[model samples]
Target: MKNMKKLIIYISFSLMAVVLFSGCKKSDFSENYYNPEKAVTADVPSLYAGLFKNETILPRYWNLYTFQVPVLGTYTQIAGYTNGSGVYEQPNNYTGDRWNDFYKNVMARYREIEKHYNALTSADDKEGYKLFLETAQVFVYDQATQIVDMWGDIPFSTAGGLNAEGKIILPGYDNGESLYNTALTELKRISDYLATVTPNNFYLSQLKSTDYVNSGDLLKWRKYTNSVLLRLAMRISYKDEAKAKSIVQGLLANPTQYPLAEDVLDKITIQPNSPTSSLAPADQKEIWNGFDVIPYPGAKMVNEIMVPTNDPRLPVYFTTNKNGVYNGVANTLTEAQVAEGATNFIFSRWDSTTFTYNHLLPGILVTPAEVNLLKAEAFERWGGGSAKDAYEKGIRLSIAFWYGINNISDRVEDKVEPPTEAAIMAYLAKPLVAYGTDNLNKIATQKWINFTIMQAQIAWSEIRRTKLPVLSFPNDPTSVAAPNPPTRLLYPSAERTLNTANYNAVKDKDNTTTKLFWDVR
Candidate 1:
C-alpha cells in the first residue's frame, strides 16, 4: 500500500518442460536432492520463488479475456451485456485454461517444492529448506481457495502427482467443504509458524534475491497468511457460523499474534517486472482495450449502485460515453436492444489508463481496503470490534486505494486527481453508503465496486454469498450454455478425458447451476 514503494515480482516458466527458476543456482544448494532430468540439484529457494509464475495470479491474456470476461464477470453481472445466445456459456477450452493454470502452475509446483524439501536428509538441511515450502504454501492455499470457490470440488488433495512425483496419478476431487477445513487449519499453523522461523544468513540472501513478491519480508507473509485465513473463515461463515466466529474473533482479539494486511501498503499483488522480461508478470493492456468482447459497465454498477451512492471511484473504474454522460448498458433489454446501445457507443466501457491501457498495472489479489471491509463484516456479524468504525475506515481506505491506482495510471490524460478528505467524508455520508442502515448490504456493494473486473472471482463470490446490490439478468432463453446466470463454472471437458475415473465421481455436480458449499443462500 506504500504509494511510492517500488513493486517487483518475477516469472520464468517453461512451456511444460521449459521452466524458469530465479532463486538459486545449483551451486548454491548443498547436494541433497537431484532432478535427474534437469541434471541439477533441486534448488528449494528457486522452486519456491517460481511457484508464483502463473497467469491467473499474475494477470495475463488467458484468464482475463476468456474466463474472467465471459464467465465469472457475467455470472455476477459485473458488466451488462446482450443476452445473446451462448453469451453466458464459454467453450471448454476457455475454462480448461484456468483449470490448467491452477493444477499445473500452482498446485503441481507447490507439491514439487514439498517433494524436494522432504527429500533433504540432514536435519539442518531440512530446517534450512523448510522455509521455502512453508512460504510457498501460502501462495498455494490462496490460489487453491479461489479454485475451490470457482468450481466447488477440485482435484486438490491428490491432483499434482504428474509434475510433483513424476507419476500419472489421476487424483480424485476433494470436497469443497473439506478443502476449506484443511486450508484454514494449515493456514493457521503457517501463520503461527511464520512468526518463529528466521532464515540463516545464506538462506536469507537467497530469499532476498529470489523471493521478489515481498523480498524475504516475513512480516508481510505473516500478515498475508492471517488475512487469507480471515477471508476463508468469513467465506464459510454461512455454513458454520460458530466456527467462522471463533476464527475471526480470535484474529481480531489478538491483533499482535494475527496481524491483518489492512493498509494499501500491505496489498498483495503480482508486480509487473517488464513487458519483455520473463521475471515477474505480463501486462494486461491487450485484454482490456483491444478486446472488443469485454462488456460495458452494467446499469446496476453505474446507475443503480455507484451513481446513487455518488461513488468517487466511478471514473476510475469506467469511461463516459460519447455524449460525456456516465450511462451503462442495461440487462433488462432484449439481445437486439442491447446490441443497438452497444453499437451507438453510448454506454460506459471500462476505464482506460487506470485499467485497460495501463501497462504497468499490477495483478491484484488482496488489498488493505478489502481486508478492512472483511473485518467490518466479521465484526458486524460476530461482535469483535466496532463494526461502524471498521466499515467507515474501509470506505476511506477504498477511496484512497482507487486514487492510488489512479496515480499509477499509465498516462496522465486519463488520470484523475484524488478527491479531498472532505469529498471522501461527504461520499461516505451518502444515504446509501453510510454505515448504519443496511450495514451488510452496504459492505457487499462496496466490495463489488472496488473489486470490479480486476478481481472478478472475489466479486462473483461475494455476490452469491450476500445477494446484495440486487441484480437481475435478462435470461437468454435460446442459449443452452446458461439460460439463467450460472452459479459456478463447469469443470473442463479435459477433465472428463484426462482424469476420467475421478471426473465421473463428481460428474453429477458438474453443471453450472450446481452451487458450491459456501454458496448456500
Candidate 2:
C-alpha cells in the first residue's frame, strides 16, 4: 500500500511539471510579449522639419526683411556702420537682431542632430528623419556662412555643440575654416546615405514631399545634394578657384544628378496660408495684418533700374497703391517717416496693391531662374558656356515664375507673347544694357529684382561678391547713424555670459568688418 501511494505522488508531480513547462514555452512565443529587439529609429523628414521650419527660422527671416528701414519700415531708426562713412548705415549689420536670432536659434538645430544622429539605433527606420536632418544642416551651414562672410571669424562647428554632460548650450565660437570644412564633409556623408535609402524606407514620412525637390524621391535627393555641392564650391571661388571649379565640373558632368530645379514642382515656395498665420503676424494691431508694407528705398531702387522694361516680374512682384503709385521712401528720410503709423501698407486691397504678403508672397529657396542667372555670371566670369543664353533664360524664367504665368500656368494660355526670344537676345546684346561690365551688372541686377521680399539675403550676398546693382548707401541720419552699412555684427551678448573663453579665442579674429575664409579679397 505504501509503494502504491508513493507511485501516485510521483505521477502527480511529473504531470504538474509538464504543464508548467508547456505554459512557459507558449508564453515565450506569444505576440503580446515584450521583446528587447531593437532601438527606436531616427529619420530625415522629422529632423528637417524640426530643425529648418521650426518657428524660429521664420522669425529670423522676418527680422532681416522687416528692418529694411529704408525700404521695409519707412526709415524707422538709425544705426552706425563700421568706419563711420558718410553714407547712411544699412540695416544689414552683423550684430543686428537678425544675426543674433539666426546664430542663437537657427544654427542650434543642426548641432542637435550632429550630437544625436550617431546614437539613434534602428537607423534603418530613421532614414527620413536622417534626410530631413541633413537638409536642415545644409541650410544651417548656408546661413552660418552668410553670417560669417558678413562679420568674419564666426562661431561655427562648436557653436551649438554639447558640453561635457551632453547638454545642449547656446552658441560657441569655432574657427571659420573649420566650420566650412566640417559642413562640407557632413553634406557629403548625407549624399552617400540618401543614395541607398528610399523615401518610404525612412522612419519618418514628413520630409518626403515633392514641395522642395523630387517629391521625396531618394534619387532626386542625390541631384539636389550635388547642386548644393556646386553652390558651396562657388562660394569659395575667390579663395580657392581650383577646388571650386572641380566641384562645379563634377556636378555638371553628372547628368544623372540634378542639373537644377526646372519647374514649379522643383520650386520650394511655401504656401502663404496657415490656420493661425496672419499676413503680418508682426503687426497684430493693424487692419492690413497680412498686407505687404509698400516700397522702401530698396524696392524703389530695384524698380527704377529694372521695371517697365525687360523684366516682367515687377508688376507680379508688387502691386500699385490706391492713388496709382508704388513709391519707395527716399533714403534721406528721418526715422519719424519710417515710424509713421497711418501710411497705407504696400500691397493691401485698401491701397489697390494686389501683391499683399498674405495673398501673393511665396517662400523661396533655390530655383531654376536663380541657378540660370548664377551660371550666367559664372560663365561670364570664369569663361566657357554661353553667358548671354544663360542670362536670357534667367530673366524669362524669373518673370514667368514670379507671375505664375508659365507654360504650366493654370490661368494663362500660350496666348500671351512671353518675352520674345529675339527681344531678350537683343536686350542682352545691347551695348548700354548688355556685354562688357554691363552684362554682369544686368544679370546680378535682375537676380536681385527677382529675389525681392523673399530671399534678399541672396541678393545681399551677390552684391558682396559682384558689387553690381549699385546701391547708394542710405543717407538718412537716423538710418545710417554712424556712417555706412556695418561690415559685421557684434558678437551676441550671451557669448560673454556663457562661453567667455571660447568667445575670446575667436574674438580678435572677427568684427563687423572682418571678412570670412571664403571672402579672400
lDDT by residue for model 2 (1-521), tens: 01222122111110122223333443332211111111133333333444434222232233433443222222211111111234333444423445555543455435445545665677564554566666666566666666665555665654545569954444455566666666666766776666665555434345554123244555555655655665566777777788777666665555554345544445554433442432223442221332233333243443355444544444444344455554444454444554451255432121112222232233455666777777777788777678887777777677667545222222232223346567666655555456556677788777766665445555556666666667656533543344444444455554554557667777785444555567554
Error of 2 at 214 (Å): 6.5
Q: Number of the top candidate by TM-score?
A: 1
lDDT (10s digit) by residue, model 1, range 328-360: 777677777877787898888887767676666
RMSD of candidates 1 onward, in order: 6.3, 15.9
TM-score of each: 0.89, 0.71
**Looking at candidate 2, what is the lDDT of residue 222?**
61
lDDT values for all models:
0.74, 0.49
lDDT value for model 1:
0.74
Candidate 2, number of clashes = 30
